[model samples]
Target: MDSITFRSDTVLSDVHMYTPNIRHLMVRLNAVGQPVFVSKFRILRNINVCSKDDIGDLGNEENRELVGVNNASTSRVDCSNTMANEKKDEEKKETAATEILLDDDGDLDVPRRPSDFVNSCEKDLWREKVYPTIISKGEEVPFEEYDEDWSICNDIRIEHTMDTTLEDVGKQIWRGAFLLADYILNNTYLFRGSTVLELGAGTGLTSIVMATVAKTIFCTDVGEDLMNMCERNIIVNKHIYGAAGGEIKVRELDWLRDDLCTDTKNPYCWSEEEIAHLYDYTNVLLAADVFYDDDLTDAFFQTMYRILSNLKNRSITYLSVEKRLNFTLRKMDVTCDAYDHFRLCLADLESINDGKTKFIVEAIKLTFPQFLFYERVEQLELWKIIAEPLISNTQQ
Candidate 1:
């Protein structure tokens, strides 16, 4: 055979790195030679309360009041007027808070400490620090007024790719992951102490976020390169969710394959014990933005059915997808073919009359609070699937 040489760095040229904030983290390469960069997502505890001015002082009493402190002793008429003013001011403050929470370029503003929330007297002390002068003296000036002991809470760091081809898109982050992560953060009680399985986890961002509340997480995907990257993300973000006693295991799960990988040579293969635990203890399933391809969508449902049928208990799945409109040559107009096909598959799944399993599908309302920062486009949607095995199927 003729000599055939492959360049390892060629993939690096096609790879792009992304980080939401300005701070830089260490970068490393995956098994496939793609450069992986860490992206930090600052989690918001309360969307309605957080503002640019009250960032790190989430529960601080001194800066907690929405309305200004008013006279304690007042007449009934004055009290009524004050109530109206407070209501109006509260609305305006909430709006402003939402607006200034993120900067123009969508970067989270630098976190501020409780001490940084200063009064008029302390403003002059840090005036020069906030606005540095280009024409400074030879000696370096120290910033004593501003608190340097600031720390961010619930910060989730994910290893992901910035730009790549559609085939390697799973290495990049998507809005669906953010939406799912937000839902988990908003309603942690539902997933608390639950054994969760995340399908097509990609960079494993949503899985990491779920680990904060879920007791156990099986973050599954295909390919060695992607699996390695996902495992690395779980390691970097362990500090955020590990304290809660949550555990995450990364494994290779190919939707195209009929059986789980059991080969000992495969590093990402599942153990016999893990496979048993998955079918016995898993109570929840999750998938984010994995419905773009028709063939993959079909395989995903097959895998879903196989896993759900094998589960010992009824399990619920939360799937998030972003509808992308494209001008197709066949349609010759704006259409979401991939999304339409996904809906068809879902309908087929629900319409199944198989004596073994029952699938119920429902559209989840998007009214839930958003805890993660992202452009939750109108096309983004969340669907809930409840898979219950019949008595006969369970007995088998």
Candidate 2:
């Protein structure tokens, strides 16, 4: 948006009259083409002067008069009088135009008033508020308009949560999620016909993308409100997944809750029984950004373990988590080392299974500038773990 600055005492007619102070007025332009004045002083005293015709150059005949003495004098008078009358006529037309422009559905085009200009500014700010921020390397990266039709991946489906309360904290989907989802989708053989489950599926962008290739997807999140929002986004973009013929089921899966295995209570939970239904047809499980809290990590892994072991055949779980370095440092004094804690926990679990559970952990380093359009944002590496169950001796 643009800002226009002028002196408060400046009269409407004074704009038509040549004044040095008002000659170099600054105007702020908005996205909607409205101009706003941002000076501490109240400029442009009369709103009536802010009409369509009055916005442009003032008619001055002295500059247009010729040089010859006799003709110049007479011409000057005639020109001055003519210009004066013309200015009056223009003013009348401007008044009529202003009236029409102010009408609810008027056809006349006119410059926006100061109030209208301010309203447009507020709207633009609101848009900025809702827009997501991409952060990498501890900095905020800029966002660009995404134009790719990512649903074309034959083996994967993607769903996006364009709106979220995280916007309240200025956190939104970054390019890291997009890149990972795109990579998995393009590698169709890895995900196609697989029964996939996405945790913390905010806006379900990744899940929707995966659903394109997955046979059946259980997109789960923690809250009912978020689940409903996710469902709405899926319905709005149903046409994108038309080619893949994948099914997307959005449900609430609270990580802290149990009893998901039974059909009677907590049916929304993801349990072995639910996994069994898809055992013959399912192959892989996926989750993104599901490791914000260490307390929840245990339950998250336990749930995955149960799901993996319950499958009749082999199944794999791919989890992507952006390590919060800040949280790690803060919690260091209160708990065991962050990285060691996770490793020891996994080791203990492996001991219980007698090494029957195989887990492979890899770190994917992502560049901040590559993932974000803004230079201020930082990038960090995301940790991905691929977990599978060891075959029994008899089966081997």
Candidate 3:
């Protein structure tokens, strides 16, 4: 039976003595049809029980302007779950937060910082540190820079500096870039006497490292501001890059543009002169830490397909990215949306394959000498991509 019933009588019972009980009684009655009671006994004082965690984070000036992350949403209480499950989960989380934030424990779940927001993806805090290293050329800096991390290779010094409060994530250097750089340093034979292009070359570190080995290195990103910064870095390290028999040029490449993969004569497509300059030097492609978001992952591959397309010679790609395993506040569990999206794109390659055009991706074995002082963590991986079946049909 429903908790509500028609009370035709005007006489009130003891159950109606309490204000809380009367409030619920009125609500239940109104749920059916009690407009008469609604007006006569209008709700005046309402009590809503809330927890300390119910209030969401209202971002500050420095917070909202950050790039690659949206404004955080507010947190609210959910009444759907039974109290038992909620209580148990709360206790488990208290333990999880303390043990998960650092690298030691297998648990990667960072604890909530006692914020009002119910769900926040800002669990992975931004941190900066100067890493010391000696490149294959046997170069090392004894003193670490106070603000920037400086890595020297073949007389070229690349300062890896980052401030988390910025909007352009492409401006920051990631671990994957360093991993790729180390690989290039060890295997200079693959890149020597060849032109190389790096996609999403944040901070241009990988390109700078590769320029020491390759013939000519093209460092490309999306924004003029980012490209300007990349150019400055390349200029600062120009001596070493030139010393290695390569010159550097920065370009703005938006991978999502329809013209990138299409032969259309749209303004967004690379100019004929630009394509002529870049097309001839087809040897290897490099990208690092470019697969962090699902929105850009497919476009990234699309750009790869466009470049690797119509190629008569073989082109190899080395993509190194660190897998993020942070716990999602919205998912309430672990999720790998970026990597999952990548796999999904790979699985549906039939559209791209079409027999005539196809890309074959293979996991580059980790047998290469562990190049980093920290070595490659389980999170970072390198993939060797090859343009298969060749481009037999090309109109000269």
The candidates, ranked best first by TM-score, are 1, 3, 2
Model 2 per-residue lDDT tens digits across residues 41-137: 1112122333333433223333111100101000111234544464455334333323323334322222323223334334433221111122222
Q: Write the per-residue lDDT of candidate 1 for residues 1-396, one digit (tens) a residue.
A: 121122443221111211111122224344554444444566765554545455544234333332111101111122245455654553344334443435565433422211222232143222111111222222211222212221224566566754466677788788888889888987888999999999999999899889989999999999887787788778766777878889999988999999999898999999999999999899999999999899999999999988988899888999999898899899789999899999999999999877777999999898875666555668889999998888644478
Q: Candidate 3: where is the Cα deviation over 4 Å?
A: 1-156, 159-161, 165-167, 260-271, 329-331, 350-352, 370-375
Question: What are the Cα lDDT values of the candidates?
Answer: 0.68, 0.43, 0.51
TM-score: model 3 vs. ground truth: 0.56
Judged by TM-score, which candidate is best?
A: 1
lDDT of 3 at 294: 78
Candidate 3 structure quality by residue, lDDT tens digits, 1-396 = 222232334222111121111111111111112211100110001101211122112122231121101011111112234433544454344333323222343222222232312232222121111121212231221222212222232233333222222335665456677678768866878888877878999778789878877877767777655565567567766655666678776766778775432234332235566566677765788998888677798898877777777555677889897777769999999888887777676666535655656677778776554222222557778888776644463642
TM-score-best of 1 and 3: 1
Native-vs-model 1 lDDT? 0.68
Residue 383 Cα positional deviation in candidate 3, in Å, after optimal superposition: 0.7
Error of 3 at 124 (Å): 16
Clashing pairs in 3: 55-116, 67-167, 75-118
